[model samples]
Target: MAGAETTRDPYAGKSPAAPLWTADFRFFFTARTTSLLGDAMLPVAITAAVLHAGYGASGVGYALAALVAPFAALIIFGGVLSDRFGARLLMVVSDAARLVFQLVLALLFLLGTPALWQILALLALVGAGSAVFQPGVASVTPRVARDVQKANATLRVSESVTLVLGPSLAGLLLAVSSPAAVVALDALTYGVSGVCLLLLRAVPMGPGPERDGAPSFRADLVEGWREFTARTWLWSVIVVFMLWQLAGAGPATTLGNSTLVTDYGSSTFGLVMSAFGAGSVLGGLVAIRLRPRYPLRAGALSMTVWALMPLGVALGLAAPLVAVCYGISGVGGAFWIVMFHTSVQTHVPQEVLGRVHAYDAAGSLVMKPVGQAAAGPLAGVAGTVPLLFVSSAMAVVTCVLLLALPAVRGLTRAER
Candidate 1:
């Protein structure tokens, strides 16, 4: 049903307007970009707040984990609900919930020192909201845009811009005002995003007939699993990403941060990350222009670049050199994301798309915390440099194996 042509063109036979000019898409873009801005600011503000409140690094870690762990745990349920009730409704509910929690947290922050547990609890609620928000947002796009590729590219470009600017804006705000102010602003943005969702008039109710008599929760999950596992290419790439992410997360995040701070300084590390974000912008721009014949192949090949960041670090390269590598990886990562999402939207049936996406996200990220948890101990035992090298090599190997799979390399784009 995803790629299938219907008698009714959702765009209503009008000539394709620029993605930004399409009313529904325009609203969606504005909402997402505004929300991303807040998300980008949140980590910095929260970390600073925790430290200022006299919590140590471990407190920061637990606080961050509280946000991510529940997000991963509940995402599959979110997907099922999105497919069941409709993306629009789920998005509205999710944003509203987030808005309430963020406002509460901001108020608490303003009142004085809040306990660590209170902060973690609030963050966990926000994360639960995200679990619903993500699938709803992703699943709604195909319905809103006539040209999925261009739409995705446009969205990625907006996200890239947000990533490039949000943290810098947060830092400046923190320098002048307080973390409470930043969080209050974030709460305000969530309210804005909720209003935008209410304004969106054209998003489809997912998987029409199948959703008529909604199955039991367990049955819905089982059906989603069947859809996810039915496609060879889909599962293969997901598996590859799980392995690749598992290998890279620790090295890129924990080790990279530690090594850079020790060898260079926080400023240099920030510059390197900024370069990576810039590369993602470049990649999104390039994706808008290039329509690869074999999208899956292209995406898989692009992933080979991911190995370079760890390799550069393993070689004990200078910060600028390692930054260059990170930049390249960012480009590849952006390309892969655009292509991968497009492929899935095209190939997967619309009714089950949200569930499949949830599975994809869950599988890809389920191991990240494990990798983060293991990285420190592993580094202690095996040494950081060697662990980084091993991760780099594993990344390359994973890319090669994915490319070698007939299912991955041979899949073509679905007809529009």
Candidate 2:
């Protein structure tokens, strides 16, 4: 699966460009890109809608939490369903449901500031669709694309581009039109994604558990858990990332705004974020052409670069220096993601890939909210610079420890 596709692996020995020309890959990529754009814009639209309705920061928090809660809770089940029904089918169904929910949410805005509860409910439904769709997206690559790394690079590029453009575009639309109009545009993008998903030809990555005496849901779940736990290299990295999110990323995200505004005479937050996007674009492009022998080793090393961002801020570096750190970190982040995802797809058995991925995704996210929520209180007690320093140290320590595992450091592309 890694060196070259074998006969048993569905599509075999296809060149990197092979996926680009294939109808299936093209359709799937288009579906994902459009959906990503909608998601990128969704936060801005939701914020504008809530604020225009005379709500405060607390309301925005509720809306964001409503969207995040369901996805975090249900994503593991999403993996189960992906393995059961197949990736293509699950993606299509997820898209369709999300489309309906987004459309309804958009319409509600047209009714003169719809109730906060109504908006939150619709956003929750959309989040559930996302929970289901994510597993399918990860598992579907080997089925349609010839080169998994290249495919992942393409997706990363799309995500980075949308991150840079979506908010700016949303702001422009708000200036020229209503908040409901911006939301309607978000719904339209979902429609485009749904159509693309419907047009895709179904391809099963592995056999379903529907044969005689097949496993029940509980049994399947247990099997998936076993597969996840059995991999030392996998779980070890998951643990490291959990700590990285809890200590490094969480504080960086929550405290960054205050740092820029207070430390610098003005807010350069937007400028630094733009630098991250730019660096991510470069990283995705680099990923498309670079293939390493030891992906985990390289990916883990790349992640350590992220420690610089927190370190730079804690030291009260100039805006330009902090921006440079963010840019480099973004590049490292992209490399880590593509390498990690490609490694997972190539190493894990196709039958249980969805379930394993579910565990991986869920575990990585479980600590993030805790970290974000605790950051404020922790900063109040420990002081901002000290907390940021701790964040920076945690990242470097965790990543270094993760690489100490022989299984991780020695993982090669050709291994099963």
Candidate 3:
């Protein structure tokens, strides 16, 4: 049903954004933006809350770990769950649950119970919501776009826009009230997202087994694992990213946050992130217009720009260099994501798309906790500058390693 022509496939030539404005894309795009904006608020808010509670680097590290650990543990299961239930309904429920979780934090703050432990718990719960929502959206993309590339570009653009808007808005909001206000606003965004998700018509999930048999949890894990390992590029990229996440992207953002925002005393951490988002928006728009010759190789090559980010920070080129590095990384990351996603969607069978995507999420996220866990102590010993340089070098190494994998390097665009 995925590539097959049917009533679901529109015969008339139309731009991708057209459907997004009219139907499935509009609802999902709104939902995606709202959720992303809220998510962008989380790190800044969490860091502020921890500082307010008089917690040191260790406490902040733990808080960050709590936010990502669940994705490592539950993302594969999240995919399986989305497949078992309806993706649309699951998405709606996840958004609503997240709203409840954010509201809990707001209430806690209002009650003066803004302890580090409570913040940690709230972050974990919010992470769980992310675990569910991401796979749901990934699983449903085939149902919306006529072309895989269009679908990939559309989703990336929507995400990039949200990333840009979320943190910028969060920064401004943080100036006016306590971090709790950001959480409350996050809750409202989720509520609005839930409402929009509820209004969408039925989304058809492609063929799979009747699912008459209830598999054990371990069995489901094994099944997802088998599905994951079978793909050469998928698992290969996962392996590279394991090192990459552990060594690079994770610490660069989280630990670097402490250095840039806390130590440097810049009120522009959110703005820096927004610059990254802006670059992503540019990349997405470029992806929409420019078809790549070698998506896999190009993606990896684009990621080399990440090496410059740490160099900028290490040199203390905060305003100008940070902005430049972020814009480059954003563009590169956006293109990389589109290539990665389009490859998966085009190559993987739709029946197992959700589970496979879950597998990807689970594997990629597994290192997030490792990085988060190690960031604080490591930064404490290594100092932020050394870690920044080391992480940047590691990212370059990882990108090079990705190029060595035939599955990734040989990948090209699918026939439209």
Candidate 4:
């Protein structure tokens, strides 16, 4: 009788178990994490390969740029495809494509027949494939989530776990043999992820063309844009994110890795990266217990942690100190990622989820190549340390901007 007196749960409309434990969620989650590990490993391995091949910082810059170049040109198309065809097929196909590309790279590297142009070409292909995989994976989460917050937390865990293992494993592979062998390991991971994805058997839920009359591509794109732009939280955060990417991610991905290669050996780079990954894992764990009253505020504040890395490096912090800086930053990044994705997953319409996610992807990543392309030549003129300083400062500014927006500062998770 007392049980009957209690009011029903507001979130009873959705499931109550954690999202990660669901069958579909577990399958896709594992597959994506495996693929992400492959992705993480490739950069470290490729960066090492280039340095070993006697390429300078400029060469490393171009290689990193190549990985992001296609995003500027083709990511919108990939997003549209995910919206049209659904995410599952796109993921399977992308993973299969990655497996093939990495396998070829591995063979070429192992045979000692590597060429800079060949590596760049392969990286471009993988980048193009990522254009499909990233949005596809993100859009699928709502279908399997118990709720938006749970979905976001689950995705964070997946990301953290992969980051934890990928770099360290890449370091091990690079140390034991060559970057080529590491590429081979990456290729195998792709294959495994693809197979696991094939075993996943859930039908996706989203809007598509009407049976009576199909909308034209242009109209569909317009609808997607409307959905994406209509949400202040969605576009505002991403606009800030785009600026942050241009100011920080490009430099960090390219120069940061290079700095480790030049200042520290491959083993040390691996350890620093492993520390970063470990920190992300810890952040994800913390996120599980944290139902922040202000999700967006928490997310914004967490991002400020990134500034520490460049400051540490600029202060000539070395070895373990550098590692610690990255670790702290990684934890912050993980928290922000969880909050941001949860915001999108929960707030956006399920029907237009793919299209909106596509728009988000395009918005968040559009400037990344610009940053990547500039890092090489800029570092040449300004010096790496100065460039790192400028980028870190910009990130801090972006984080501060988050405090001004009431929408973000006072956001909260839906209650059960």
Pull out the clashing pairs in model 2. Answer: none
Ranking the candidates on lDDT from highest down gives 1, 2, 3, 4
Global lDDT scores for all candidate models: 0.82, 0.82, 0.75, 0.74
Best by TM-score: 1
Q: Tens-digit lDDT track for model 1 on 61-180?
A: 988889888899999999998988887888888888998998888888889988989999999999999999898766778777877777787788889888878889999999999888
Q: For residues 282-364, what per-residue lDDT tens digits would candidate 2 score against the true structure?
A: 88988888889998888878877888778888898888998899899889889889888888887887667888899999999
Candidate 1 residue spans exceeding 4 A from truth: 1-9, 12-20, 204-210
Deviation from truth (RMSD, Å), model 2 = 2.9
Candidate 3 has what TM-score? 0.83
TM-score of each: 0.94, 0.93, 0.83, 0.82
Query: How displaced is residue 4 in candidate 1, in Å?
Result: 6.9
User: How much is the lDDT of residue 240 in candidate 4?
Assistant: 83
Better of 1 and 3 by TM-score: 1
Cα lDDT of candidate 3 equals: 0.75
Q: Backbone clash tally for model 2?
A: 0
Model 1 TM-score on a 0 to 1 scale:
0.94
Better of 2 and 3 by TM-score: 2
